[model samples]
Target: MKFNATLLAQFFHFILLLIFLRIVAYKPVANMLKSRQEFITNNVAAAEEDRKQAEALRQQYLADMQKAREEAQAIIQQATKAGEVQAQEIIEAAKTEANRVKDNALQEIAREKEKAVAELRDQVASLSVLVAGKIINQTITPEIQHGLVQDFIKEAGDLPC
Candidate 1:
């Protein structure tokens, strides 16, 4: 085949067009693609950091809840112990009051018994005096009167206190 000058001229033109496209359009498109890739990577890293921070916060909240529960338990125990102590104290106070009342009642009963006995003795003495007066009113000798008085005195002395 005979070489054509027209063919050679078209080939050179095609090569020049390719070099021009590489210098102008290809470089700018590549730079834009690189910038886009960097932006995507940076966003992914930031999201990962935020997720880690959220996890830490969740763990902290759980720990705080546990501490609060423990504190509530301790408070309940203390209140129970205090209630028991107060109950015991109330029981002791009641027992002491009951004993004191019992002692007072016994003492009052003894005093009442003594007072009744004294009253009975006075009554008996008065009756004896009345009987002696009646006897003396009737005619009797002085020696007989003295003897009767002595016997009455001895009997009165023998009465229970």
Candidate 2:
């Protein structure tokens, strides 16, 4: 084998170029890659934290909505109960009013019946007096009749006031 000066010089120059590239370009590129990886990892962690917070907020919102629904249902129930009570009270009042009206009608009818009976008794008494006067005119003497008239007047005057 023959050794050449040019080939030896070229080999030395290639090794020196490799050392310069490793110191200047490769090291700086590796550092830049490491910094970019760290930045990406921090961004992913922040996104995960945001997701967890969002999930917690969603659960809280759902709980609040459920509580509100329960409250609304309770209010509706209370309103229904109150309405029923008021309706019952109104029905009771109407029944009471009806009973009172019936009682008043019965009382008025009784009063009217008593008035009719009194009028009928008065008519009967007047008829009896007329018959008795006809009998006295046919049979009694004038002196007897005058004495009876005076006696009837005295008896009527002496009755209770």
Most lDDT-accurate candidate: 1
> Candidate 1, residue 129: CA error in Å?
5.4
Please write out the lDDT profile of model 2 over residues 6-112, one tens digit for every residue: 99999999999999999989899999999999999999999999999999999999999999999999999999999999999999999999999999999999999
RMSD in order of candidates: 7.6, 9.4
How many residue pairs in model 1 have overlapping backbones?
0
Worst 10 residues of 1 by lDDT: 152-161
Give the CA lDDT, 0 to 100, for residue 65 in model 2: 99
lDDT of 1 by residue, 63-102 (tens): 9999999999999999999999999999999999999999
C-alpha lDDT values of all predictions: 0.88, 0.85
- Give the distance in Å from residue 113's predicted Cα in candidate 2 to where it truly belongs: 2.2
Top TM-score prediction, candidate number:
2
Which residue runs of candidate 1 sit more than 4 Å off their true CA positions? Answer: 1-21, 124-161
